[model samples]
Target chain A: MTRRLSLFNLTSLIFGFAFLYLPILLLVVYSFNASRLVTVWGGFSTQWYGALFRNEALMEAAWVTLRIALLSATLATVLGTLAALALTRYGRFFGRTLFTGMVYAPMVMPEVITGLSLLLFFVAIGLDRGFWTIALAHTTLTMCFVTVVVQSRLMTFDRSLEEAAMDLGAPPLRTFFAVTLPLIAPSIVAGFLLAFTLSLDDLVIASFNTGPGATTLPIKIYSQVRLGLSPEVNAASAILIGIVTLGVVVATLLTKRSAARARRDGH
Target chain B: MAERSLTRKLTASLVPALPYLWLGVFFLVPFLIVLKISLSDPAVAQPPYKPVFDWSDIAGFFSQLDLDNFETLVGDDLYLSATLSSIRIATISTILLLLVGFPVAYAMARAPERHRPLLVALVILPFWTSFLIRIYAWIAILKPEGLLNQGLMALGAISEPLTILNTEWAVYIGIVYAYLPFMVLPLYAALEKMDDTLLEAALDLGSPPWRSFWTITVPLAMPGIIAGSLLCFIPAVGEFVIPDLLGGSETLMIGRQLWSEFFSNRDWPLASAVAILLLIILVVPIVIYRDVEARRLETES
Candidate 1:
């Protein structure tokens, strides 16, 4: 099985990557197409890119989406890191089962259910559905994802560094900030990036919890898409894909560098 | 020293408490509210549901709540059919994902160690992209004048464009496309960890490759298979965006129905009932996932 690629293996890899990649590649290529028709190519042009910038409402939604992503990702990172610490560090506590369930449930729960339930909760509590509500919803949903990422890092985390720092008389908080945080910082950043992209990508939760004046980029693009295919949406999606790709690349490089550093230092 | 110990204890307990409180309020409490709303009657007022749970008149609030929404769900065949259809669609899509995902995962697992990471990253890169955009990409490809049809036509494979968009076939393709990563990642993780010697041992005993693969590789990969299938199947059951965007208006998935119930029809109580039922249906699989995760963590730790 580990030998040279058989026909089955070669075909699978070729078709798999093509299937995974071709659609998005086509979408990106079509963004620069001169034709208004989404699929057909008259020639290469960046008209849609120009139109994307000129579209005021879409721009506003994009701005809103970015701010929400930033705020919620930062918040989710902190909370999720704490939750990871709780799960990994704390041995056993009251309601541990329930705590674990709550953290994991949101990760796999249906968006519609999560969205609908949150909207209901907001209504029941008399909280207005708007920017803050959407942020809260995104935080709740994305924090679990953050927890999963950070928890994996924490599980494999070396404890001797913190212990050595403690043995040298550093306080717990100081040790965490000075030692543990630096070592796990890469994962924290990774978790933040994950949360950020997820928040940016979410449409369902935002849709349910949204109110007047809180349209996100996905919502804007969705409304336009429903009307018909347009090069404008292709341009917008291309830009979004570009941002996420850049973030992922940066995070991957950071993690790789840190891993290499750890290997060097370990020996 | 005593004061320091007290502060340390306070923070020690406090760390777990913060996230506990956050999830308890936002995650657990909201679910309770959904359950309560589902049992209540729908109204035309603000919030669109009745029996708002007046704390002072708790008795009255409890009395007002009934199984009306659940009754509605039972009496009407739409909800039942939608739920059944969603299950059917999710089941088939999970199988298709396995069919498409297994070979790629196996190939990736068998790839050179240095190249495996890059392959994994490529698989995950698209997953990190927007779900809506991915489905939107399919809309362009599957449409009559879209890429697939045009490519086929140009190749002289067909004289006329095939209509695949806005059909169940499109939904299947979209699910397989989107969830391939979910399926592959876990399977790769399992398969990659497998010991090569066991398969070799089987073959050394004169068993054929296919026989050894079925008996050795498949059983060893059971955990991954289960994990991957549950990962894809559970969420696929309650999927909203894929069905709404890719499937036609006639698509009867519960997620789409719930969206319409809550958004277009404004039947908040009924939507709550739908959500409750969906949660109930998925409870078994979710619990299984949690059990598997707990065991995995236990073993890892």
Candidate 2:
């Protein structure tokens, strides 16, 4: 019976993995196809990748996306770390629950609502919809992710270490820089990377706020897909997938190494 | 010295309140604007700005509200049906995600400790890519002359190519593909923390393995199940991408309808009304998540 159950489990694993990844694998394969038809198997070529480079609008949109992601992710990390520090350290204060809820609300709220509400707010404030608006919206949304990551890290942290630094007559700011920051550095980096990816991949919020000239890569690809599918978009997607995968792997390796070092140093 | 200590305490208390002020100005205020906009009449094109405090506009606002937008919503068979369709699609997709994600999460949980990281990475790999790219890939697979149909045709499985793209099935596939990792991660977390002793206890009691899983494993994993369901369902309901990409012109989900009402029709009031209604539906799950988290916190404390 146990053997049968193990067999069933393996089958389930294969089927599940295949179901999740097959479509993506097919997409990557067809990016190199010589024929326009996705399945024709007319010899592989790098024509699509070449075509992707030649597309001016796609390149421009990619530049816009990179700028927005960098700006928003940086701002979100700083603000979110502060908020997380405040929430985790100072418990049971007035409106503490409300503060946490507001911070988290943006993450769960539908992008449509977030986008629409922000758009309306911009109009009300007489701020024109454009790249700045997009950045602001992205910052608000990504901050929640940063907060969650940082908060989880803060939860497991020892508070006595900071108190020890204070007992040594160190100023609070100096103690934070000399002690707390180093301890939570991994979580901060992870939060930043997560925010960066979210900002880069965002489409719905960007769509609602972006002006004609401020089109991001996702919006550019969306408009193109709406008109028709092209292998150039496929090539672009494949390239993005490659870059992101490399970045995540590096981040994970760094985190694991730091953790291992921490464990060793403890001994 | 005492004054300095009091000042430090005051600063510490004020520090947390600062983030809430930022949230209030940006997040909460925008939602308030949406609520105000929904109250105004769309008949008046480019309506003048009425201060939220104006008593005269308040009466006019609520009096004119007349449920016209909502009545129009319910009266329009198309909108009503589309809302129901959105719910149904989201429900089915959430169930599909759980079915596919559960065993994969189980494998990740049960794997030798050294191999678990790689398995977890695999589950999150697709998530790192752009959501649009993954959904766009599905178009390549499901289009009539797409890969799936072409392969089946070549294999003599069908006489002619099957039309899979631009259908409801395609939407389901896209949703399940997009959200599977969300289900997997939480379930993995839950299953990883699960006590092996419970299953051992059940086995010692002469329960079969399958029966033990159904009775012992699933109940303990209910929190993860609920979390994953909400994670999948909430976003799926307001999903603009999958239905737009896969469902074609015939599929009129609420998100698309809301988009059209705002962008295509330029009916901001009506669109805001639709958005507000969607927010109302979402509140149930939002509240549930809050209550669950609060309960967990209390229990831990």
Instruction: Give the winner by lDDT.
Output: 1
- Could you report the Cα RMSD, in angstroms, for every candidate shown? 1.3, 2.7
lDDT of each: 0.91, 0.84
Model 2: lDDT equals 0.84
User: Candidate 2, B8: how far from true, in Å?
Assistant: 5.5
What is candidate 2's lDDT per residue for A149-192, written digit by digit as tens? 89888888888989999999997778888989999999999999
Summarize candidate 1's per-residue lDDT along B1-301 as a digit string, tens digits.
Answer: 9998999989878878888899999999999999898988888898787856777998888888899889999999999999999999999999999999999999888887878899999999998999999999999999999999999999999999999988999999999999999999989989999998998888889999999989989998888899899999999999988888889887889999999998899999999999999999999999998888777777776
Q: How good is model 1 by TM-score?
A: 0.98
For the predicted complex of model 1, DockQ is 0.74
Give a tens-digit lDDT track for model 2, residues B35-133.
Answer: 887776675444333333455576655655446677787788888887888888899999989988898888777767777788788888888888999
iRMSD, all candidates:
1.6, 3.1
Residue-wise C-alpha lDDT for candidate 1, range A1-267, written one tens digit per residue? 336777888789999999999999999999999999888989999988999899999999999999999999999999999999999888898888889989999998989999998999998888988899999999999999989888988888779888999999998889989998987888888889889988999999999999989999888988888888989999999988998898788878978888898899972
- By summed lDDT, the worst window of 10 consecutive residues in model 2 chain B runs over B44-53
Position B41, candidate 2: lDDT? 61
